[model samples]
Target: MAQSGGEKQGKLDFDESRIDSGIDSYKSISREQDASSDRSQEKEKACVTDERLDSAYVSSSLNVDSLGDIIEQCSISECESATDCEYTEEEVNFLTTVTEDGDTILHLAVIHEEECFARQLIDLFSPELMDIQNNLYQTPLHLATYLNLPSVVKGLVKKRVSLELQDQDGNTPLHVACEQGFWDCANEMIHNASPSKLSCVLEAQNWRGLTCLHVATLRKHHRLMRLLLKNGVDLNLQEGTSGKTALHVAVELHDAPAVNMLLNKGANVDAAMFNGCTALHLAVGRQDATIANLLCQAGADKMIRNMEDETALDLADGNDDILALFPFDDIQIMGRTVMSFS
Candidate 1:
């Protein structure tokens, strides 16, 4: 049974050769698998690039369609008289998307005074775009106020469009209505807006810390001023930065009507400004003798001084008539009191 040692060793060598051949076969399979993995990764990358290209193409085509639609709409006069053509729901929806400055169809329709288009837009797209803000942070209500379209403003308010919406400067629709002197739009806002919402409108300050009253006074809009004052706006409210009251602005603007309105509304005639200058001082320094007489008649103190301690007479610059308005006892005119000036 014991074979020769050389024959047994030869059998062992043959078994080792078989094991080495199996190992070489496994290595070749692993190399092929790695190459296949690389090819699959390349195919995935190609797919991503193709998808991006397809997206670009689709976007380009949509842009072309949008431009073409705008051009066609401009050239055609059929839409001018909205009664001539009835817009389908789909067509109205499309118009809603092609907005100028991010405004919806309802916004443009109301602004352009297109009564028929506005009605159709409200009937169809109001639920979708009623709350949309244009690029200028103006809602349809704000636009309506700016354009003095009371009908559209009423319709939007009746539909319960947001009255509390703010623009970029945090101004409400009422602010726009008041600033533009649109009494009808202002009335609509005041009537339909809630008490809390109205508070925001009345108190809402622009970037200049000016409430609606401040704007009305600056523009010398007497009607708007009366409307705001009647609506409970503070008559003596001072600007946050300038500490100037509506009376001060009225005096500066030389608007006799606005000044009288403010004075009658119980505005402080002698309220000092940021620099400690009163309306009387401004009226005198600017040579507004008429406003000066009004201020004096309203009991504005002639001795009111600025931060530099200069009185209204000090600012009169030798105007004898202006110097005579102040009681000589109250004002030191040329180092003398009323005894010398009169």
Candidate 2:
């Protein structure tokens, strides 16, 4: 199924005009499923509760799979049944039990995409359980967003789970979603987020000092890039470690389309990175005529120099097409100072 006639992330080739309706339907399915699943769960809650087999409990980072298997086993009976009988203190404790790597049962549920069991756990546990951070410092909400499970995402959101909490690497759920190309999840996180959360989550950076936009660009997620831009992200924001703007990434990767899109969206064509390398310099160096043309068309200043004091013209080498974007006489102009320049 195509979404907008464009092949975005291998999803349906849908038409841009249909985007609103398509997303509306897409989101509607998630909501409808959640509602029906909730009602079905209500019916099960009235029935008998299944006890976790003793084999289901374990305490080992190496044994997470074993725990995941046991929980998968329990999910079969518990998630489908409506038994209201709550978890025993010991079972609850087991639910909260963390491996050396710090994953709770809730984390596993989201990982396995066991939506029913996950929601049931959410219903039965204290709100604090949702906030439990694993060894990676990812809360259940983070796991759900990273895993791109809408049901689990909504379950956490329904509880008003904290959205602004940063992981060990300093990424909020928004960063995880954007970085991983989970567009729908990103939308859900942003749409449901409070204004304060929107600010913090959008601005939050990972260890590399990359906002969600940087990751989106680095990963070539066109749709995600638009979503972030539509949400009012700072386009000129450079990577903390690399000091490269999104345009620099597109040009370096030889992604002409991304270069065009970023330029249209207001990415500074002449913006420099950590080494002071601008997109124009990268485009010329890469011999990407299309991107070089796009940059020129967008009014990229060919006169800008990197820290190495090299302009796009100086690095064009034998690529006459790239060399042509500059003024015809610029070479002669640079020649007078070329010896002193390099």
The top-ranked prediction according to TM-score is 2
lDDT of 1 by residue, 211-318 (tens): 888887887778877778888887888888989888998888889988888888888888998899999889998998898988899998887779999999898888
Q: Write the per-residue lDDT of candidate 2 for residues 1-342, one digit (tens) a residue.
A: 223354212211112221111111111111112232323454344333223221222212422223333543353233233234334455455656665556676776665456777887787666687888866678888878776787788768777788877887788887888777899888887777777767777777788888888888888999998898888787888878878877887788887787888888887777888887888888888888898899999998888888898988889998877766776533345446333311
> Once model 1 is optimally superposed onto the true structure by TM-score, how far is the C-alpha of residue 147 displaced, in angstroms?
1.9
Name model 2 segments beyond 4 Å from true. 1-100, 124-127, 166-170, 329-342
Q: What is the lDDT of candidate 1?
A: 0.65
Please give the distance, in angstroms, between residue 65's alpha carbon in candidate 2 and its true position after superposition: 11
Indicate the TM-score of model 2.
0.68
TM-score of each: 0.64, 0.68
List candidate 1 stretches off by more than 4 Å.
1-100, 119-129, 168-171, 330-342
The 10 consecutive residues of candidate 1 with the worst lDDT sum are: 19-28
Local distance difference test scores for all models:
0.65, 0.68
